[model samples]
Target: MNEKERAPIEDTHFGAVTVRQDGQDRIAVDGEAIPRVTLERDPAAETDPHIAIGTRDPAHLTMRVDGVEVGLLPAKGRFSRHSYRVDVEYDGAAYRFVPDSIPSSRLTRDGRHLGDFSSDGDETVLAEWREDGEIRPADAAIGYTLASAFGTGAQPMWMMIVDGVSNAIP
Candidate 1:
């Protein structure tokens, strides 16, 4: 039997979650191994996406983490993009993860628009964050908000459209 090879997708980490495509596909949150994590369309499948140039309508990935699944990140099509939505049960209470409309200017915890993205340094990591439900506009450091909310954040450059294909993470 022969084996196929692909470039190693660098693992991106936020809060406790780490997305990696190394050996034996893996996703770990806060060091807890997420058994049987798979990315696919609504029906689910065992496949790796080869995003060709000019590919539109980027597929949606429903990440099954710890049996409490959520859409990992919204897809940006040729004409639009969608905000991140996540809902998880914490301490028997339902907590929802929501973000402001793009340009992803702000984010919220449980529907409360804590604050907008900070205009700090070039650290294009987390774009939504708050303390005690208070965030100051212009304090734009998007970090640990999404991951802390549903268990994350991404780089701003990650949102850039590369070669006609959006690199907003898979």
Candidate 2:
């Protein structure tokens, strides 16, 4: 498959949280750098080598942003479809992750939202994004929310190369 591409916007980022994929998901935005929750397929730190994220075993991963623990999606999602949800408690508000459900997915809060991501086929470029009801440029929510299922034309939407790392319901 060809890599996803988008027309670069000159300085689209303005006091916004942007995420971009820079060779191995550097997780950066607007020339600034931010840490992200990491997902290791076969983490050496894991005690059991047999435990792996696949069809049966759930993915045991930690989601961190800017070197801070933001959430945990440890083997609770459907591994069969590479779908997982990382529950998070940030700033006294609860947040949930939608691991690529078809063309897009989202990171939501109580009544509002955190991030909304959308894409057509290319998992690399998130076409639309919204955070907290604010319309953020596609890459504004950058840095990256790497998932087990990025997208690959798989049957299940989660299995597709990528659901969406940004936010958008419309």
Candidate 3:
């Protein structure tokens, strides 16, 4: 019998929630050292799970996967310029903890990345991050307030476009 060779896809697990490769739209569930892939919103079987980060006077934030709202900040106005973290576990792996605000930016109609996050343990490996490009005025609808703080000259607001195709880790 011949063996089949399969490529490794990036995945992470934090407690109970698991984020598939590249933090794409879908996540997996781990059970007894086994992994079960979940179906995320599709853009041609190509899903892009996203995280968004921003600051507000009241500190209201929400996280969604592929347009499907997954988590919400019930306690609005709880934080002020502070970073919130949530680590999810899936597929027997632990993905870094991230805020809903981070992915929201990617899921937006015109979302972009602001920066990347280093792995919790490895410091050298890039766990996850946002795009490093400038988001257009149209894309800055909700991020405008935060963007203003970064300046509008050349950098404006640090952003990134998640390339799910890469299948990298958080």
Candidate 4:
């Protein structure tokens, strides 16, 4: 039988919750051992690729949270090349994940500051958030996924220097 080979699975923890991605298509939360999240890709889709939660089916690009279907959409960045934003609305609040640099992104809702997610070495960390206790597990999960997929981990000082020198030369 011909079966697609799966990539090595990796688990990343964000406080109490654990997110596991198979490095290919599957991503799960809290040791569910089932594919509760996936990256669905379609050349014809406006978003092209979407983060699917609660199922592996490519047709379902949205996840139901509290009876509300939250869909992830990719919006092109206004000023940067090769950078984009992921937008989602959950519980009546519209959230946007904007990549600020190679290793971090800021989270905002309706132009209000909310939180920031960044890569620390090999791990993604929720560096800060609103003090009023507005962030949720779903928010963390989605944010982590976005960071893992789009943002690069923190680079060593040597690597950064090398990159800087290379860019300068070119």
Best by lDDT: 4
Query: What C-alpha lDDT does candidate 1 achieve relative to the native structure?
Result: 0.32
Order of models, best TM-score first: 4, 2, 1, 3
Sequence-dependent TM-score of model 4: 0.53
TM-score of each: 0.32, 0.45, 0.20, 0.53
1 or 2, greater by TM-score: 2
User: Any idea how many clashes model 4 has?
Assistant: 0
lDDT by residue (84-156, candidate 3, tens digit) is 3332222232222223343221112212343333321110122232355542221221122122111111111
lDDT of 1 by residue, 67-170 (tens): 55543443332232233344433323333443334334355445566544421211122343455664422111112223322222233333544623744546
For residue 25, model 2's alpha carbon misses the true position, in angstroms, by 11
Task: Return whichever of 2 and 3 wins on TM-score.
Answer: 2
In the order shown, the candidates' Cα RMSDs to the true structure are 11.2, 10.4, 17.0, 7.9
Per-structure clash totals for the candidates: 10, 23, 38, 0
Candidate 3 error regions (>4 Å):
1-19, 33-81, 87-170
**Best prediction by TM-score:** 4
lDDT (0-100) at residue 155 of candidate 1? 33
